[model samples]
Target: MNLNELRDRAYKTACDHGFHDEELSNEHCLCLVISELMEAVEADRKGRFAKVPVDKKDTIFDERTFHYQNKYFAENFEAYIKDCVEDELADAAIRLLDLCGLRKIDIEDFTEEMLYGAEESCNDETFTESVYAISTIPIRYEYEYDYPLGGQLNSMLLAIFGLAKHLDIDLIWHINQKMRYNDLRENKHGKKY
Candidate 1:
């Protein structure tokens, strides 16, 4: 998945949906990313994951849109596939990518750099610990003096991709589904923030 393209799409979608109506502080953007990571941690603790049953995998994508709009699907399949650990990770990635797009960072390069080494580096850290570490990486952009925010964000993206790999998540698929869902939602997703 070309990350820069996804970044562009994510940011554009956010702007179109009114998230960009006013200037957003970097802290606020990273806070949203951290929020998604926190949700992932909760999903892990609760044993939630986006595991499409083997029998359903073949047809899930074919009927993706139908299920996305269905109340039953929203309650059941949504819990299984949309509010799971992997999906939350995808949300975290999308949030970061949107930030990168807003700042015009070249995330595709960072994504390519991290692709092969992802599953190899995070073996020593538990999933929750690693996620916590990733969450911390983005905050440095707000407080540290003279550190390039793009580079710090790229580092966080590396950690996020590593977690995604360790979990065997098809993040691109989840991100696509999420982008569609985001497009259909109310402004600021009905949140005051």
Candidate 2:
């Protein structure tokens, strides 16, 4: 499916998982996204990757039990561990998509605009420079919009996309896989974070 379709699906998945049960403030959403990014950073630091338990019946998605059975990690454990950064990056995008869906933002359009802007900025600059430049795009919304957090949210989404590109991650596929795994979590990943 296309980006918009993916966004819709991501949003629906979040709702199905009870992420939309309460009205979260923009700052809260931003924090949630950032937390995922931090998790990615931590995963990278420890050379960790996302893995399913070998014994699916014994798996518990709760945070407390999530990492209790490293020995029973699924096959290709090494490869999956190496992909921790990418997995976390996908998670960040998933969070952003869910937020956009909740806010009724046209994420596909914004993503296109930001990506083009990033490309243009990279013509005479490094990728890092381009990302820094793109990060500033949210300033306009910060003051002009009633929901000032929109700017922050947009900036985070842009950065996530940029990182995904750098990491060669197919966010659509990762999001789909992550969501499917999430679905298998008890109560749809409820209280797991």
Write down the lDDT of every candidate, Cα atoms only: 0.79, 0.60
RMSD of 2: 8.2
Compose the digit string of candidate 2's lDDT tens values, residues 35-152. 7777776766776645544343644433344342433322333345334766777777788878877887765445566765643445675434443443444554566564355446
Model 1 gets an lDDT of 0.79
How high is each candidate's TM-score?
A: 0.85, 0.63
After superposing candidate 2, which stretches have Cα over 4 Å from the reference?
A: 49-83, 109-152
Distance (Å) between predicted and true CA of 70, model 1?
8.7
Full-model lDDT, candidate 2: 0.60
Q: Give candidate 1's TM-score.
A: 0.85
Candidate 1: stretches off by over 4 Å: 53-57, 63-79, 110-113, 139-146
**Candidate 2 to truth, TM:** 0.63
Residue pairs in candidate 1 whose N, alpha carbon or C atoms collide under 3 angstroms: none
Clashing pairs in 2: 49-81
Best candidate, lDDT: 1
